[model samples]
Target chain A: DVKVTQSSRYLVKRTGEKVFLECVQDMDHENMFWYRQDPGLGLRLIYFSYDVKMKEKGDIPEGYSVSREKKERFSLILESASTNQTSMYLCASSLRQGNQPQHFGDGTRLSIL
Target chain B: SQQGEEDPQALSIQEGENATMNCSYKTSINNLQWYRQNSGRGLVHLILIRSNEREKHSGRLRVTLDTSKKSSSLLITASRAADTASYFCAPYALYNFNKFYFGSGTKLNVKP
Candidate 1:
């Protein structure tokens, strides 16, 4: 079966600390994305990578960055954790084109204190 | 920026009843997709309708897209308690299919 794996199901970090969220997909998809889901705002894009080492800014890329060192793996980095950044982070993978469906990992619920 | 906006932010219905959700977008799109997410879980893709396609169906889920109106709707027939989840509409712009925007979503509550 196809699967997208997130390294952590839950994470906690202190303010001003750096945090890393990891995601991997075994489906060999070309497009990977990072999004944060909040209570009223829904899911807001942070960043996405189409190919290894190629990344693009999403709608809300202010407090986040991503790295794609391998096709199967994508990493989201939080330079400095803040309380407002606490939310559920979702990672997804899809075919090279958007016409195809995207596969998602369970998600990493990060809490910044 | 989010392009799609789902109407009836929340809906409540009894089991075996049909549920319909609407979505409106502000720009041209290459395709529109629907997704469902249970509480505390990742989103699951429900359906996708290309710009050229008007309607598509899968199982009990039906999706309709109207490019002229920049909107779409998802219909769930005989909804079960399991169908109670948040539904989101995503609209992809132009050639970048992966760059779609998602709305806040419509939370459906199917009471048994």
Candidate 2:
């Protein structure tokens, strides 16, 4: 079975503070993604990395960035956390091939006060 | 822009009954996938149906796809308490399979 682990399950930060959410996947998948889920809006993609050091912006990439320094780890960075950024953040990983199902970690619920 | 949209935003059914959810997409797709998310948890991939295929099943879950209408339906037979969760559908575009677009899922509650 594939396992994806997020560093934190619940997080709280003050406004303007920088926040970091870490994710690690044991399966060494080539594709990693970061998304923020809000009520009634479903999951909104923030950023995704197809390979180490390569990142692409998704639909809702503003106010957020990502880092993929290694194949097994992907990081989501909130440059300047605002109240609007408070939401459940999910990390997922999948193989590079098409039609592959993504494995997800138990999301990090972020609270920006 | 969102590609898939699920209808009947919420559903409530008694245990042992069947629950059905529908998803509609805007463009042609290579394949469509379904996922379920328990409260406060990340989504768990349920099933995937390709465009060429009309129907697929896994355990008690049955998924049917209609390419002409760009719609799909998921039927859960003999619903259990554990089956209560928010269900989402992701439609992968024909040319962009890597970029996934998910809609506001259908929330199903099963009464014991």
Candidate 3:
């Protein structure tokens, strides 16, 4: 079975603080993604990495960025956390090619106050 | 800006009943996938149907896709209380290699 592990399950941060969320996959997948889920908005892609040191912006990538220094690890960074940035963040990974199914981590619920 | 949308945002049914959820996408897709999320946790991939395949089944779940209409439907037979969750449809486009458009999801409640 594929395992995707997130570093934080629940996180609380203050406004204007820098936050980092980490994810690691054991499947040796080449694709990694970050998404923020909100009610009525579903899951919106924030950023994705196709390979080590390669990143791409999704539909809503203005407030967030990503890092993929290694194949097994992916990180999401918030430049300066805001109250509006509070959301449930999810990390996913899949094979490099084809329309493969993505495996997801448990998710981290971030609260900004 | 989601590419797919689910119909009947919420549904309620009794145990042993059959539940169906429909999803519609805006553009052409390489494949359509269904996912299940319990409460507010991460999503679990339930099924995946390519554009060329019309229908597929696994266990008690059945999925049907219609490329001409750009729609798909998921049916769970003999639903159990444990089947209660939010179902989302994601249409993977050919243009993007590592991205998918996920639907808002359909929340289902099963009463014993």
How do the candidates rank by lDDT, highest first?
A: 3, 2, 1
TM-score of chain A of 3: 0.98
User: Scored by CA lDDT, what does every candidate get?
Assistant: 0.91, 0.92, 0.93
Q: Among all windows of ten consecutive residues in candidate 1 chain B, which has the lowest summed lDDT?
A: B93-102
Model 1, span B1-75: residue lDDT tens = 436899889999999999999999877888888999998889999988999999999999999999999989999
Q: Model 2: what TM-score for its first chain?
A: 0.99
Instruction: Estimate the overall C-alpha local distance difference test score of candidate 1.
Output: 0.91
Model 2 ranges off by over 4 Å: none
What is the lDDT for B67 in model 1? 92
In order, the interface RMSDs are 1.4, 1.3, 1.0
Using TM-score as the yardstick, the better of models 1 and 2 is 2
Name the better of 2 and 3 by DockQ.
3
Clashes of 2: 0
DockQ-derived CAPRI band for the predicted complex in model 1 = medium
Cand. 3: chain B TM-score: 0.96
What is residue B12's positional error in candidate 1, in angstroms? 0.4
